[model samples]
Target: MPGRLQHKSALITGAGSGIGLESALLFAAEGAHVLLVDVNLAAAERAARLVAERSPGVQAAAFKADVSKEAEVKAAVDQAVALFGRLDVMFNNAGIMHPADDNALNTEERIWDLTMAVNLKGVWWGCKYAILAMRANPTDAARGLHTGGSIINTASFVAIMGAATPQLAYTASKGAVLAMTRELAMVHAREGIRLNSICPGPLKTPLLMDFLNTEEKRERRLVHLPMGRFGEAIEIAKGALFLASDDSSYMTGTDFKVDGGLTSCYVTPQGEQVLPPPASLI
Candidate 1:
């Protein structure tokens, strides 16, 4: 049988590491030609090599692009089309959680500006260009492909709930992503483009691990998680895959939360330990 995303093309941002890198691998494994975009060209290239090694014969390439810069983002999208013939999925997954991004009063202007530039404005640019490309996507009858595609933006559980350890700018920027994704989905629904935001909970990714460095800091947050542990990047990548594929054909403008039940719990239950080991691609 053919893979779920066989013959489709995908472009993933921040493909150097974390959720982005894992998604690139998963997309390629599922037979989607993938273009991994990152500001760090070497990192992206390394990820592309991993794709080739792990999923041989799958088309995977790397490009250098800073999602915060519109020109670079546009160029990356163009490169995906040039290499893969069409853009079937756009994962706007590049973002930053600045170390100094504390509460509203403590966070500096530069930190807030930088977070929004990458997390909010970057997502906007990705959506803008991806929609344009998907609009003109050529029908590939042989591959069962057609115009329109899926756009998955990475938001956070913090976008819907408050965090006591406040990364104010990071939280705010994600909230904006959810909002922007909803409006864009509405605007492009008729055109066959589907837009949705995937809201992940606190994860064990480097981005959050660096912030929750101290044991005290980590415990402070872990106590609230019903799962009694942080999430993994591959878990989020699995959610992105669903949004990218035809499995979610009827879904659009949804705030798809793969948040380990963080947004729903008041007090986590304590019981026998049987949690599955975290998934990885490295």
Candidate 2:
């Protein structure tokens, strides 16, 4: 049987690690020719190797580029079109959260700039170039080489709800991403292209692992999570697959929350006044 993304082509940034890397593998498994783009050249190549191992003869390659840079973003998209003949999906998933982003007062100017540049500006550049490439293809009505494509941006649960631990810059950047996804979706809704953002909760990716390596930090996070666990990278990958495939034909500009019910519960059963038992205590 043909896969969901049979014969499709995709360009995914941050494909070297975490959610982006997992999604690249999943997309390839679904029969999409994936172009893995990342700032880390070696890591991207390693990911490409893993994909090749899983799906022999799979049309998946890695590209090195900084999504925050317009020239790099344009060139990366151009390369994907050049190699694949057409682009069907674009996953803008590259992002970074500062270690020092514990609170608003402690977040330095440099941290804010870096976070905003990569998280917000990078998404904008990816969308701009991806859309341009997709627009070059003939409209879906024509059914030509490029019949438009899907764009998936990565947001976070922090964008939906503020938490006690404040990463002000990260939160602000992601909030902009949510808005941008909606506006862009409207702007290109008639062009046969779909745009959406995925909002993930605390995930068990390498990035998160590095951040929550300590016992105290890990337990602290579980307290607020209704599911009492961190999300898996594969979970986010599944969300990307849905948005990238025609499965969500009518969906665009929507933010799919992959948080472990973190955003769903306003008050815990423990009561608003009473805090849930600590993860260790439980």
Candidate 3:
């Protein structure tokens, strides 16, 4: 049987590590040609190699692009189109949670600006260029391909709920992504383009692990999780896959939360011993 994303092409930002890298692998496994974009060219190249090793015959390449810079983002999108002939999925998954990003008062102007540049403005540029490419996408009747495509932005559960240990800039940037994605989805719905934000909860990714360095810091966030543990990047990648494929063809302008039930609870249940085993690339 053919894969869900058979014959499609996808461009994924921040494909060096974390959710971005995992999603690229999954998308390729599902039969999509993938371009892994990242500011770090070496890491992106490494990820592309992994995709090639894991999914033989699937096309995967690496490009260095800083999503905050419109020119670079446009270049990356153009590269994807050049390599794959059309852009079918754009996953704007590159983002940063700076160590200096704390509460409103403690966070510096530089930190907030940097976070917004990468997290908010980055998603904007990704969507803008991808939409333009998708609009001109050529039909491949024999392969069942057509114009317009899916766009998935990485938001966060913090956008919907308050965090006691506030990364104010990070939270605010994600909230903006949620709003921006919704409006874009509405504007492009008539053109067959679907846009949605994937809100992930606190995860054990290097980004969050660096922030929650101390046991107390980790526990502070963990106590509230109904699952009693942090989430894994692969879990979020699965959610992105659904959004990218025709499986979610009817969905648009939605906050698709794979948040480990974080947004739904005021107080989490206690005394659970067994939990779902974490998924990883290895």
lDDT of 1: 0.93
What's the best-to-worst order under TM-score? 3, 1, 2
Question: Which segments of model 3 are wrong by more than 4 Å?
Answer: 274-282
Residue-by-residue lDDT tens digits, candidate 3, 84-182: 999999999999999889997899999999999999999999999999999999999898889999999999998899775879999999999999999
Question: Which of the two, 2 or 3, has more TM-score?
Answer: 3
Clashing pairs in 3: none
Q: Which of the numbered candidates is closest to the native, going by highest TM-score?
A: 3
TM-score on alpha carbons, each prediction: 0.96, 0.91, 0.97
Q: lDDT by residue for model 1 over 143-185, one digit each (tens)?
A: 8899999999999999998775879999999999999999999
Q: Give the TM-score of candidate 1.
A: 0.96
> Which of the predicted structures, 2 or 3, would earn the higher lDDT when compared with the native?
3
Which lDDT values do the candidates have, in the order given? 0.93, 0.87, 0.95
Instruction: Evaluate model 3: give its TM-score.
Output: 0.97
Tell me, by lDDT, which candidate is best: 3
Number of clashing pairs per prediction, in order = 0, 0, 0
Q: Name the 10 consecutive residues with the lowest summed lDDT in model 2.
A: 268-277
